[model samples]
Target: MEDAVGYRLRRAQLAVFQQFNEAFAAKDLRPTDFAVLLLLSCNQGLKQSEVAEALGIQRANFVAIVDGLEEKGLVERRKSEKDRRVQALYTTRAGSDYLKELMPIWAEHEERLIARLGGTRERDQLIHLLKRLCD
Candidate 1:
């Protein structure tokens, strides 16, 4: 009675992300925000275009993400020293601290994902196959 593939997959995806959303709610951060912060922490002073490219997000859509991060006081965009017209993005001190606090929870979430899907290899293959379907 409950075997529709679309329903199952959508529910599974929502369940996984809902766990993440709950874990980071205290910091008022979304998964994408956590990703952006982590990326900036590792690749300090990256350009917005580079972030957009890495995330596979279009420039227009990325504006909303940037605005959210800025409003949360998690990141700042500044004029690039070499190219005044280009803006470089950097995570703020609060962002770094928030990431530090959430790192363990993120790790646990990854473990839960693997457990839910059997194992990492199985999950990876599932994702690869799903991606091909989209293609």
Candidate 2:
């Protein structure tokens, strides 16, 4: 019922994010953690700052987030070969395995939203438009 785009976007985000949290509750992972895992899984090795930037996470909070993931055994950080002072992030075996399990659930979650939006074709176009809005 919200006419404003920002309000509608926020409402959609909240509903979907809550569902994602519930879906991942068994693993005790939050939506943000899932995003970090996703970035680490796809990128072979990246400096922590790069991950944070790509994910739009703040530098100050990202350190603690990565530390928590490291503690959960989902991620590992090492001294970047390019820069000994910077830490590089990679998903651990456990993280990769967890992603395999979560991907299907993520797909299903997306299907529900796509259904509400119309269909696969519409969803794809909508994503393109949304990306444009963000960029």
Candidate 3:
């Protein structure tokens, strides 16, 4: 083999990340930040801990991420109506609007990546293998 799996994966990650960084820079969103917003869009009113767990992010680190999104007016942290002690996360109107714009761009980006990987079939195979590794 010309290279090991880890080396190839790292190189591919770096290449895609560079493209992602450039694509989102104009929108003032990093990939990590985008993940949080996207999560909130799909799971409205999710508890802080739930978001952290779903994202595999440390609770402490996730707080800073949520706080930043709150500061940006992209998301809000509100006291849960059902649980006085828990704060639920939700995307703001502005956040939803941003997502409306970003989703198409995201789709295009994903398509480009899938093409680079060879096609939909190859991309599917890659995802299947990657999921096995992750598990």
Candidate 4:
């Protein structure tokens, strides 16, 4: 069981998420919340469906996530001028500022993980392998 790749990956994911939860506990953010804010920050004006698809989130589940962020003032949905039927997502100014504050914490978290994985070379290799698996 210890040698099984899937089991190992699941365990690693749990540990990483546990660390993440601890680090962001004060801010009351979850991994998925951070991901949505980050994505909106990078790509403004993306339709809800587009964002959901890109994040590999189901539309139904994605709506509740967006609603929560919206209530928190971290994200906003705007009617697309080009398509009235579609709603585009954007990170609020507060969201951008929040991300700026979170950046250092995020960096520290990543550095810790990278160090645990034996530095940049190993980190890069891990990412590459992970990407291959994802693809």
Candidate 5:
């Protein structure tokens, strides 16, 4: 069981998430929150459905996530110019500034993980392999 790929992956994920939660505890951000915020910051005015689909998150769950961000004043939903019925997601100025602050913390988190994986080369290789699995 210790040598099994699935077991190893689960263990690694748990450890990574623990570190992530600890690092962002003060900010009250989670992995999913970071992912959603990062995506919105990069590509503004994306529809809720589009963002949910892109993130592989279910519609129902995605709504809650967006709501939380909205409450945090980091995200906003605006009526899409192209479609009056559809709402698009966007990051506020505060959200963008928040991301800038988070970048260093995120980098440190990745650095710690990379160090554990042995280095940049190993990290890249692992990322490649992980992408292959995901695809």
Candidate 6:
């Protein structure tokens, strides 16, 4: 009787995000940074604007993120061959190696969380339903 669907949903989301934050802290990475790295690795030669759109981040916010990653030398911003005005983003060699090292930890973190949440089926269903809400 006390459970409100909206409130419970928000709480669950926060809890999951918090856990991810904690896990990434071990490698001195923010959740957003990890996501950015993964995105670049998966989609090489994506433009900054494309990354922003794919990640659902505002252009203004993404600028700072790109700056930070570039400063760290984990990402490179190169002028596009086709468009001098546009820059494309790519992960550096160091970034790819760093991601490989953290990949196992990331997998374990996901497994632990899913196990705590009643295992793979429930976790997948939860993610699917959340995506449905956006659609």
Give me the overall lDDT of model 6. 0.90
Question: lDDT by residue for model 6 over 1-135, one digit each (tens)?
Answer: 249878888887799788887877768888788899999999888999999999899999999999999999999999988898999999999999999987987998899888998999999998999899889
How many clashes does each candidate structure show, in the order listed?
A: 0, 0, 0, 0, 0, 0
Give the residue spans of candidate 6 off by over 4 A: none
Q: How does model 6 score by TM-score? A: 0.91
Q: Please give the lDDT score for candidate 1.
A: 0.87
- lDDT over C-alpha atoms for residue 34 of model 3: 87
Candidate no. 4 TM-score: 0.97
Tell me the TM-score of each prediction against the true structure. Answer: 0.79, 0.92, 0.92, 0.97, 0.95, 0.91
Ten consecutive residues with minimal summed lDDT in candidate 2? 20-29
What candidate 3 gets wrong by more than 4 Å, as runs, is: none
The CA lDDT at 74 in model 1 is 83
lDDT digits (tens) for residues 10-55 of candidate 1: 9887998899998777767788878888899999888999998998
Distance from true location, Cα of 11 in model 1, Å: 4.2
Kindly give the stretch of ten consecutive residues in candidate 4 with the minimal lDDT sum. Answer: 33-42
Instruction: Estimate the Cα RMSD of every predicted model relative to the unseen true structure.
Output: 2.7, 1.4, 1.5, 0.8, 1.0, 1.7
Report every candidate's CA lDDT: 0.87, 0.87, 0.89, 0.94, 0.94, 0.90
- Model 4 alpha-carbon miss at residue 29, Å: 0.4
Name the candidate that leads on TM-score: 4
Higher-lDDT candidate of 1 and 6: 6
Candidate 2: give the clashing pairs: none
Range of the 10 consecutive residues with the lowest summed lDDT in candidate 6: 1-10
Give the winner by TM-score: 1 or 2. Answer: 2
